[model samples]
Target: MTTTTSSLLNIRPNFFYDKVINWFPGHMAKGLRIISEKMSSIDVIVEARDARIPISSINKKFEEVANVKERIIVYNKCDLAEESSQDIITKAFEKYRNQKVLFTNANMDRNIKTIINIAANKARENPQKYPFVTVMVVGMPNVGKSSIINSMRRLGVHRGKAARTGANPGITRAVSNTTIKVLENPTVYLIDTPGVMIPHIPDPVCSLKVALTGGIMDHLSDEEVIADYLLWRLNNFSNFGYVEKFKLPGPTDDVNVLLPAVSKRIGALHKQGCLRLSGT
Candidate 1:
């Protein structure tokens, strides 16, 4: 639970870390523009975020574009986060009484129905005016947006995955041409949009959290920096799960000391027998 950085000693500054301040690419801009254009048709905006890094995963730009629509903040991948922390995360958003926050595990179909019901209920507030509910699903990359859409389709229509799901980020590149129908009674359609990031992530730590959680592309950030940050995070909470997982001699704060040991323990070596610290 500690946030001290004294453990990270003598680490050289990285170029990628410095440049990641303005990591926004052109595609993100285009995606934002597309979302803005479709705001007129969207009845509800489902903002998906990683349950582990809820605060950092949120795209601040969505607030400006989706402020008018009914926003449902879904903290996806709840199964991966600590169950005890859910209430704490929920309470953090209590101020947003206008917005509804739901923790969901899309892969397991948990809370899928509730999310649909909430969106439907919100849209039905003006049933005659808004007959068809058009829900726009937005979130950072690799946060299970497509998985949630697919789950909704499975429950609403008993159909298989309509939106493609992947383990990495940026799978949904842009808004799809075809609409995915999630419910039949009230006729709910979901518009799957690409995972868009803010134009600039001013805080480096926030950027690292996003990178470590796979919100941003892996190649965009150096592997070692991300791994190191992960190590620091694990050590901060005194979570030595990695020590057992990697079969290390003991828990160490220094990634330099840890990575080599991990590389050796796991036999992660090059063809020439050199230890692959980066690979580890």
Candidate 2:
């Protein structure tokens, strides 16, 4: 919410919401290339991921890209996830790399201090060429990389925001740098990279989950498909709140049967886009 240090030229498609769809665009192949190229100088690699879907949200090739650097996992938006699940995920991630895992809510500025301390200590102990501790934050879109930077700036630096934040995808387009000095001792410079999804996400369920969770652009997804996948997941979990909420007679796995009823109940006459009523 603070003033950004640098203005991000975030371009978004402002088109009419009338029955138009497209595949996921803005693949930042260059972003990954930059991360790989810049990893040589980075002391610590902070992989920011959504706390809700810890394992699914992380990039597939992160281990390969960040293999050389000291890695620390920062599970952002911890407030939305269960504390018990966070503990399990943290422990599960321990074997991959002997690293400290931190769960943080950048929005609330909670547990962010621990993130800075862990990352800073790791950087300082490793001894890099850069005088200050150099840390690069990487994650898929909408995973809260920018918010984490702002959180660090607020508590550690108490200054302006280094990276831009938005509710939608593509808020961060390029690599941005802003240095925040932690009050304690080591001055850490955080480099915020553009959110980069894997080039080829092979699993359909994984792709749907990512899109539904806002990791990918909404326009790139079929609304019906997203909703259908969501319904399937809800059914699989044995959660039938939708049946009552939508005023359906009984639980139905069909999105078509449920979407129109809810749409009409909410006085939404144009029940076309964002949800398909027909079972075509």
Candidate 3:
């Protein structure tokens, strides 16, 4: 909670804020190593990503692992992101002819079924010439991998009855193996890996918003300007209407007019006489 001001930028800085910016811990390095070691045994890789930020959620390093096996991209939380954004994302991935892309709300039963069907198709089309097919579920924390597995089990697609599911994020922390019989064609095996936040080229502004809105930022940043930038983006982006409903102040064409407008809306008043528009 200690706040420090940066003389260079005239911005307040805090150690807690630094922690938020650096939330992706070093443990991911070990996770990547483990995934690399297990790639040989995996037949098809199922990657789950937030539909809101599909491109950002994906780890570029996945290309390295995917080169060894078939990759199926699952766009989870499709219900959250804007429809137009989702369409753009689907088209963007269409160039990867080798990969199969699927959009679904992993929390729902039908979408989970669709995912299973697509995965089965990907496994059957595998050119590796392997006798048995294996699919590994991967994604960032809270992307709904476990929930999807549980839904598959409910539909009787997954054979083992002991698999557990939960509502919270980071529920599945270890690799677990399970087997299922796919309607008399062949026996399918699945490997579930621990969800790790994929590291990417950081955009401090966008990352801050994603982390804060999704509860991913455990430590709050001390830089209010960063938050201001986020508010500005949210206000400008018509898709993020919820932000305006929160009555947050946002920048406009003219700082003078915009400041007073936002200050009144956010209830920031000056102690002496006028409204304190500086912070807004």
Candidate 4:
């Protein structure tokens, strides 16, 4: 738990901090190439980004490939974030990408209506003679690309779970072979593409946020490191929910001390000398 604002800004450690994290897999590169090649067919690119770390979650590969197309930024997980923060995110992302931004909650049915409305509105801008409207949902992994599709289906036509949902990132390894119909009033179809990540996460802050938000695979990150980062964030905001949730002795910055307590409380290690969750 940091006490001041300067500590929040300076996430880079004095030593022992790696500037970059390698989260890109071979599948991601393939996915990026596929999205780049297929960009011509998409009428609208609905880029889903996490609300908590708006600035950090943008996948640059999507920008390089889909910049020419009409983009709608979907700030997913609005329920997890504060209202004021969501407003700030909507504005910052709108200005940064020069695209329309809509805050959405994919798990619940709320705010799902605006997605197709925006897509239909974008489709109308072109005035094509096509019979159906095609929308491609894309973003970093586990950012609700699939969940968004299912939510639209549930909202628009009373369908259920059109796409898979999970806790881990990179669940959707590639683009779907066929489009899922989410709306019928204007007849909109959505293409749920695999969430793509930049090849190298150069900014430590961005990588931390991505990992914290489940955009990157946990195996690639040290769990203790991620835990410490989360602790710092909760402390920065004066959030002591962990104290009650984990039964801690107040709050602590050292994940070294925190994890053993947590591990013991959760019955993770029965005969531990010093707890090592990495299994090294």
Candidate 5:
């Protein structure tokens, strides 16, 4: 294990290192159009964000489409984030009049009932407006939009998955004709759209944070840079669980030292002589 420590490592102010990330694709454009067209019928907008990177995960483009709708901010993957940070995140959205913020672990069904109830309650306000409640789940790539719908379906209707789910980004390309039914009483349905990312990231810092959360495509950004940013964040926060997980002698801020030890421990090897640690 590499145990040599150099002078105090200054946290990198930026992770992009002057690299530009182009992540928006044709599918996202079409998805945005579909969402815009369907917003008239959408009674409630369940904006799902990655709880770990709550602020950075916000798709700025969504503000135009979702500003007028009844929005509930569901910060999914709460299990992956520090519980102490939830209150601080929640306090940021206190200015919104009709918006509700919730932290949920969709995989474990935690707070799924509350989400459904909130949406259902909001939709029920106007019984004459529509026959059924149409709720749209929206967010950046791989922030668990489909997973939240699937969880709500399993709990609300006791049914199988209505939306396809995966760990990678951009699984659902469009809002299909078949909307998933999450609640039967008063007739509630969910529209699962493709994970939408902002067309232009404001800066390199925002790009790296979004990329680290898997919001942007992995190939578009250097994995080593992303990994180094993660290490810097963890070390800066004094969180050193990676030391035990990677079998390192102690915490190290250098990605060069940590990556090699992790690669050897995880047996990551490329076909050629170079070591591959992309998925680590």
Candidate 6:
């Protein structure tokens, strides 16, 4: 939706401050330590990722722990991200023959079943080497890691949403592992891990935007820049009504115009009838 500088300022404060600052907790460190200890038992690593921002969602430390293990990258939340981005992510991971990538929407029970089957088939391919296949589920917070596990447990029997789901990140906190025997040929054990939030490595503002907005597009300087950019990109789509509803003025290409426009919309004014664009 297109939001004016003033309106955005009114709705959200601390325009320059980073949104949802994330830090690695002691529990996460303990979980990682546990995963490391059991790394040898794992036959395959199932890495779950947010389809919207695959790169940002992945935990960098995973590569070190997953060294030399068969890995499968599952792109969750396909319904939210654009189809083109999905294709690009899938193709990018295709280069690794040992790593199988699949796109799925955890909310849909059927899709989750299919993913389980795909994971089973891939695990069974090299059965002679490893008799028991251990699959470790890893992903960022709120990426549906727990939901995927509960769905698999129901075996398509329960359709209702049972796993804890929310917009606020870092809901899953502990690691839960279980075993499932498929067709008596391959005994697969799946490990569900707590969501891990890898600290952002780049611009703090950009990182905040992703945490708050749930997706990262082109970088913008301020709230106005973000709103304007979103408006321009979504204008061609059928959802441009937000622009008119908010009565926001058309945005200029310049980033300098954003701060003042947002300040004015939010009534950030001082005693002299001038806009208080800075210093709270």
Best by lDDT: 5
Pairs that clash in candidate 1: none
Please tell me which predicted candidate would have the highest TM-score against the true structure.
5
Query: lDDT tens string, model 3, 125-165?
Result: 76356456677777776677766666655554544433455
Candidate 4, residue 38: Cα displacement in angstroms equals 1.6
How does residue 48 of candidate 2 score in lDDT?
88
- Whole-model Cα lDDT per candidate? 0.81, 0.73, 0.59, 0.78, 0.83, 0.61
- Candidate 4 vs. truth: CA RMSD? 3.7
lDDT at 94, model 4:
62
Stretches > 4 Å off in candidate 2: 1-27, 122-131, 177-184, 265-267, 271-280
Every candidate's CA RMSD: 4.2, 11.2, 9.3, 3.7, 3.3, 7.8
Candidate 6: tens digits of C-alpha lDDT, residues 1-280:
5544443322222344444345667767877877788888877777777777667677778888887777777788788878888667766766655567777776665366665565567557766775666677777676667666666655633334335656655565667554533223445556777776564545564455455354332232345555544543444343545445445465333344544545556778676756674455
How do the candidates rank by lDDT, highest first?
Answer: 5, 1, 4, 2, 6, 3
Model 1 CA lDDT for position 240: 72
Q: Residue 253, candidate 6: how far off, in angstroms?
A: 9.0
- As a whole number from 0 to 100, the lDDT of residue 126 in candidate 2 is 58
Score residue 187 of candidate 3 by CA lDDT.
Answer: 46
Query: Backbone clashes in each candidate structure, one number apiece?
Result: 0, 0, 2, 0, 0, 6
**For model 1, what is the C-alpha lDDT against the true structure?**
0.81
Query: TM-scores across all candidates?
Result: 0.87, 0.78, 0.66, 0.87, 0.89, 0.65
- Which pairs clash (backbone N, Cα, C closer than 3 Å) in model 3? 4-13, 270-276
Give a tens-digit lDDT track for model 1, residues 47-114. 99999987888888998999998889999999988888888877777855655889999999999899
Off by over 4 Å in 1: 1-21, 122-126, 264-267, 277-280
